[model samples]
Target: MKKYVYPSEISGTIAAPSSKSVMQRAIAASLLAEGESRITNPSFCDDSLAAMRVAEGLGAAVEKKSDSVIIRGGINPVTDTLNCGESGLCIRMFTPIAALTGKRMVLTGEGSLTSRPVSGIEGALGQLGVSVKSNNTLLPIEVSSILKGGTAAIDGSMSSQFLTGLLMALPLAEKDSVIKVDNLKSREYIDITIDVLKKFGIRVDNHGYNEFKIPGRQKYTSTDIAVEGDWSGAAFLLCAGAIAGSVSVTGLNSESCQPDRAVITALRKCGAGVTVEKNVIHVKSGSLRGFEFDATECPDLFPPLAALAFYCKGETVIWGAGRLKHKESDRGAAIISEFKKIGGTVKIDKDCMIIRGSSLTGGLTDSHGDHRMAMACAIAAMGSSDAVEIDHAECINKSYNEFYDDMIKLGAEIK
Candidate 1:
């Protein structure tokens, strides 16, 4: 699908979407809790749906409602194969959970996920006594043998997702486990995982982000919980408000542990009007100027940050380009290439992405099947000189299915 976004002044209020990160983790935890878990304000994005299907495949009964999900948790392997769709988190996090059943199963995914390397998963699970086989270190991973808890080590530079899987699955093992991690990134994501585990009555000891101790034979006690609003998704809306006009976003926890909350700092640094009160964040247009931000721990911010930078006065430097290679697309390259198509300047130098603020000429760009890329381009178009045409705009459904509608509600002229 293609979307045409014209320059417009947006003004209004909208509730932020539910966080898929939290929703998926909640689904995984519910599947292990052995009783009914009520998750309120759930996300129904494609990624969250994939996690729900995986939970059902593992023998959980999931009931979906308009605003919440009720899951009766238990793992019995109703299917021999689980399809995770295109969510990287679902495949990485559920592999260990699947191994807990000690039943031979294949964990696979579609689209970009199939090409992502799973060797880290194989190596990590092997150390715990689970037999893992993958397609040349890629997806379609086959796993057997129970996770017999023991000491294991993992290289965490690439992603913190596998560690999340280990942490979620380890407490159920017959023996206690120890995990020594090297070069862990996205530590905040680990914090989110631990927080969700606690809600499920699971415990894990963290040692300076390098090691984790898990006591075995722990049972997950189901409980009612509400999924937090996604800072990652809200960042784009906040950026939209920063560059165009006033926007007020509610449903966000001011104290969210999600790293993308750093968007608030970046916006303030760039001279955007920002006001925070309770769960509400209001951003309005200001004398925007380029600013520097370190995105090493919040790589997902790069796209929206780039959009915000496009309308600023000087130059914007965002650190952490190295983490963009393995996302839905080579996200850095996608941003640079697509932004250039719209008459914006962007370049990557080693580990940094630099953008020079200028008037966007407003032309055609492709989403490259990445949801963030699609949203970023759309947001950048909101202040452009002409209508910006985006290809594959449907990609937004991956994370924020209602993004375009929300923008429309905020007075953006889209066709």
Candidate 2:
């Protein structure tokens, strides 16, 4: 799918997309509960659907309705193979959940997920007495033995997802489990995990993001959950408003543990007019200026921040390039390479990305099969002098299926 985005001033009210991150965890937790669980305003994005399919493959009866999903939870598996689509979260988070079954199971996925590392899944699960194997460090991870909870030390420098998997899985183990994490990144995501766990009647003692204690034999209780609006997806819409015109995005939680919610602070610091009240965030074009932001915890913000920097006056320096190497694409390189086609000056200095504000002359770029890269290019187009043609723009369906439509609704001339 190719997208042609013309420079246009956009103004309107748009509802933010539901958070697939939260939805996936809710589906996982719901699958563990022993009764019917209802998820309201559920996300049907590709990743969230993958998680729902994972839950079904694990023996949960899943039914999708107009506004909610009904899931009946159980641990019995009807399928020996669980396909996670292209979601990194599903593969990592579900690997441990799948191990709870004593029967052997094979977990696989498509696209970039097949190339992403799974050694951490193997090591972490192995230490907990689950027999695991992976295709080198990639997918096709196989677990043959039931997960036996015990003390384990995890290397958290790469990603906090492995720890999240352990945190979610250890509660159902046969014995109490202790997880000691070193150099944890994205601690906020762990907070989101804990929040979801609590809603499902599980308790995890988080000790300063370094240690976690989870009692085994813990059971999950099914209940109704309302999925929050996604800050990560909303960042693009908000950036579009900051660069082009006034736009009000509704449904985002001001208190969301999502780290990408920091984009609001970045907008305010860069001189964009911001009005925050309840779940609606109104952003208007203003005198934008360069600012420094550390995205070490919210690495997904890098792409939108790069787009936002194009309208700023000076130079914008964003830290945390190291966090992008393992994403759908080498996201750090993808952002720098694709944004340059639109006349944005972006360069990487060690682990920091430096963007110098300049007039944008939009041209052609590719999504590189990354949803955020596609949305970022579209946001940059709002301030461009020429149309921005994005190849593989449909990649946005991974998280925000209606991203272009929402932009069009906001008066962006995108086709």
Task: Please write out the lDDT profile of model 1 over residues 158-221, one tens digit for every residue.
Answer: 8999999999999999999999999999999999999999988899999999999999999999
What does the lDDT read for residue 125 in candidate 1?
93
Worst 10-residue stretch by lDDT in candidate 1?
110-119
Candidate 2, pairs of clashing residues? none
Q: After best superposition, candidate 2 residue 275: deviation in angstroms?
A: 1.0
TM-score versus the correct structure, for each prediction: 0.99, 0.99
The reply for model 1, stretches above 4 Å from the true place, is none
TM-score of 2: 0.99
Candidate 2: stretches off by over 4 Å:
none
Assess the local accuracy of residue 388 in candidate 1 as a C-alpha lDDT between 0 and 100. Answer: 93
Residue 353, candidate 1: alpha-carbon lDDT: 95
Give the alpha carbon lDDT tens digit for every residue of 103-134 in model 2.
79999999989999998778878889999988
